[model samples]
Target: MHGKFKGKHAIVTGGARSIGFEIARQFCAAGAMVSIFDYNQEALEIATTTLTNEGYRVNPFLVDVSDQLQVNLAVDRAEEIAPVDVLVNNAGICLVTPFLNIEAEEWQKTLDTNLSGAFYVAQRVCRYMARRGKGVVLNMSSKNGLDGEFGHAHYNSSKAGLILLTKTIALELAHLGIRANAVCPGYIRTAMNTEVDSDEFVEEFEDRYIPGGRVGKVTDIAPIFLFLASDDAEYINGQTFVLDGGQLAGQKPWKWLLEEIKL
Candidate 1:
């Protein structure tokens, strides 16, 4: 609660749960007024009510980030509540399917939600941030964004586009006093990972992958968002912070390599 983000107001897309929710939690803990936006009305209500009861100033907005009209309306509505000082484009979707078997509609949906959604939200939010002459933007990406995955062609491509979009947005908005950066995480343990967190999958994944001997937690990645959104990161922009616990340090798990090298 002692960071440079104190007293700022933020809009966190897809903040109903998972990494988005954790980001909102830390921001509020750091003394920022947070508005959580998500299309999931149930989770939105639950999150907002829970935070409100805890004495944090939180408002929930129900809107689909992928739709331009919805994005604009949500931003306008949020602006009415308070000027947006920071924006976290955390709303995105991921699906695993072979590249050859993926359908055109599914591919379009992946890009629309994962890549274009960030664009739509940023386009609207930055207008106000630009006028104010000082604001921050954080985009949620994945390690697959850097390295292509076998069954996640659509998701991987969208995230790759998002990373570049983040870089370009940073440059375009820098002159206006706005900062943009992307966070690329790997195998975070959130509700989104339930499908992969099963016993068999865990045995398969953590057995050979995740050199740290564990999957990542939402809390582990939350601070990066909090940092990028704060004045402490004023000089940091257009960069992607990877939070995979040495999963991408090299071709081999660096942790295991270190153990062997030490022995």
Candidate 2:
């Protein structure tokens, strides 16, 4: 559990906060030198400072993943610090809008950030992995990628595209010893979710939808990223691991019938 990544280098996109931040922290705790890339300068500084203060190796870079030039530059800076052995493409954006009301600009922005950004970051980092003949790429997908959600046309489309993108990367890079995988999380207690949903709604939704009786947390996800990036998961490739507390397992009609009988 400890030092599984000792002496390795990891680059985590969107690592300034939430799930991304937790992943970066876990990697550092496992003894990997970590570089956090984020668009938010203030958050990046704070996270980097906090991790460093905790006696962890951490470097922060301000880069927008949607911009290829910025991603390239950030990779260069990260490589200067250490050769990247693990790349976590965790940066993305979601815009919830009805399909009929979604504007062209909004759709473009969502895809550009969620899909194209992951592509740019992965391609740039995988090139180095290819040269080294070994690396791991973990993409942050969403449960919405597998099932449609209301008022999330753009978000769902981008995540669906990312799943395919992950597969393509895995197939192409497996020959080079670079494994690619995706983690599809549902109802995580992140700022993105809390910002939109009220406390009452969160409590009700968890009770109704999550079979595990609660929504997931950042800790629930970070370890999986570490496992996939570590040597233990060398054979795991081109797979999307859904961590949703069985939310996608479908409703139980038999259970409904039992309830009806009781009524």
Candidate 3:
């Protein structure tokens, strides 16, 4: 119950599970009164109960960040606990559909949830931070955002847009004592990804993309996020951190690439 963020308040969208939950848990453990915003009532209940049982302070709100009204009202409610000191913009959804086959509804839903939702949450919470003249915003981007991935045109586009949104937030808000950044994670072992990717697919993905030879764990991501939330990262802003196990490092010619070249 004693750490760098003691007495601070953190708002984590999508905090009901996976990477978001880990971030909220760690923040709560570090003594931040964490407010979790998720659209899922069951998961939210489970997450809040888990933290409260562990002697951590946490509040839960069923918020769909894509809806501005929901975002605004939830922010107001969360502030009743305390002013927002940190915001982890993590609420997002991904549907695996081919680009040519993507529906208008699917495309809109992806952007609305992943990109616009992040915008709504950040805007609402940063206002609270701006008044205090200090706070942090951490947007959850993904490796897919920066690089091309098969079967995720909508998801990829939304995440890519988030990177720029994060940068713009930093540019405008840094002067107000707020810093914004994006975290781009690689093949992390989260339920969201696991549901879409098979066990064999995950192994193959690691063999081809991840140089670390294994998929990343939520543990690999939460610590870096908490770091960005800490005062130690005061000078770091408008930046993107990639935790991809060298997937994007442009490795030397592999079997497929060498065969394609056939020199």
Model 1 stretches with alpha carbons more than 4 Å out: 253-263
- Among all candidates shown, the one with the greatest TM-score: 2
TM-score for each predicted model, relative to the true structure: 0.95, 0.95, 0.95
Query: After best superposition, candidate 3 residue 254: deviation in angstroms?
Result: 4.1
Q: What Cα-based lDDT does every candidate model obtain? A: 0.88, 0.91, 0.92
lDDT of 3: 0.92
Q: After superposition, how far is residue 61 of candidate 3 from its true place, in Å?
A: 0.2
- Pairs of colliding residues, candidate 3: none
| Candidate 2 residue 130 C-alpha distance from true site, Å | 0.5
lDDT, residue 27, candidate 2: 95
lDDT of 1 by residue, 1-263 (tens): 46556768999999999999999988988888998989999999989988888888998989988899988998999999889999999988888789999999999999999999899999999999999898899999999999888989999999999899999989998999999999999888788878655867865676577777788889999998887877678899999999987878855545656778753
Cα error, candidate 2, residue 219 (Å): 0.6
lDDT of 2: 0.91
Task: Return the candidate ranking by lDDT, descending.
Answer: 3, 2, 1
